[model samples]
Target chain A: MALKPLGDRIVIKQVEKEETTKSGIVLPGTAQEKPQIAEVIAVGPGGIVDGKEVKMEVKPGDRVIYSKYAGTEVKYDGEEYIIIKQSDVLAVIE
Target chain B: MALKPLGDRIVIKQVEKEETTKSGIVLPGTAQEKPQIAEVIAVGPGGIVDGKEVKMEVKPGDRVIYSKYAGTEVKYDGEEYIIIKQSDVLAVIE
Candidate 1:
């Protein structure tokens, strides 16, 4: 099953680092204060949300940095994804 | 000094219950999960915030119920108040 976000929300999945590291080392991401990086999987049509005008800026396949505490975790078809509003996205990674 | 909220934000102070109850019993609000009731002290101008058009609805002296965890606590002149977005307010008490 595919997850389709509603409103100004978007679904994103953490972009896993390459498993083959140059030093063959793996560092877990839980011990840092850095923002999370994820790839957008689905984009919602933006309009009026909560009486506010919202325009969707990110699209599917775009890498983005989002607020640390934002987004709701949803499991779909045994795959985990985060659903967050466009406002929660801090920036797009070029 | 007075606090001036910005961008659809509002400064509110928790409404203190009457010191004397009919039964002379006092119950602290922290023990419950009920939404907090606050009185608006300052209101910001409705404008664009984070790329979204926001219109301020509540005014000073209005009583409102806001999202339980949606405000920032600020201490000014030894008085405590909460600053939150207007969207955080769920309802206004008539």
Candidate 2:
């Protein structure tokens, strides 16, 4: 089965904490609330959401940081993925 | 001090559960969770938010139903308020 997000939503796989630490990227969350680093797997088409126009900014393969509490978790094909809106993505790592 | 929310945000004061029960309004939350009924105290001027254009829907004095985990709580002038995005407000109670 395939997963397709809707309306500026994105699907991502969490990257290991050790790998993120090795990259030396600073996370925005506090010690008790550490933000997550993940790799973009799928991106939704930008369109109107809640009466507003949203443009997708991150593409598949891009690594991004997002709030820990943002998005919904889904399990598919024996793998877990997080589905979140593009707006919840705080930063993209180059 | 007064709270002025920004970008489709709203400030609300939660209504007591007893009052809601007496009003016979069915809440959306499950047995373990209960959605809150709140009175709109302040509304933000909707505009560009996360690159999207948002227009405020609820105005002051409107009662609304919101997610239990949706918003940030703040104490101002010895009173408590919840600050949440307009999208988090599920419905306006007439």
Model 2 CA lDDT for position A59 = 95
Query: TM-scores, in order shown?
Result: 0.45, 0.49
True contacts kept of 2: 0.06
Interface CA root-mean-square deviation for model 2? 12.4
For residues B1-94, write the lDDT of model 2, one tens digit per residue: 3899988889999988787667655444444334567899999999998877876767899886665575899999899999988776644544
- Candidate 1, after superposition: displacement of residue B2 in Å? 1.7
Model 1's C-alpha root-mean-square deviation from the true structure amounts to 12.3
Tell me the lDDT of candidate 2: 0.74
* Stretches > 4 Å off in candidate 2: A1-48, A51-94, B26-34
Per-residue alpha-carbon lDDT of candidate 2 for residues A25-63, written as tens digits (9 for 90 to 100): 656778655688999988866677776678888999999
For every prediction, compared with the true complex, DockQ reads 0.03, 0.05
TM-score of B chain for each model?
0.78, 0.86
- CAPRI grade, predicted model 2: incorrect
In the range A1-94, model 1's lDDT, one tens digit per residue, is: 2544555777788766663244243434453334677889888666776766679899999988776453455443456666667888888878
DockQ of 2: 0.05
lDDT score, candidate 1, position B78:
90
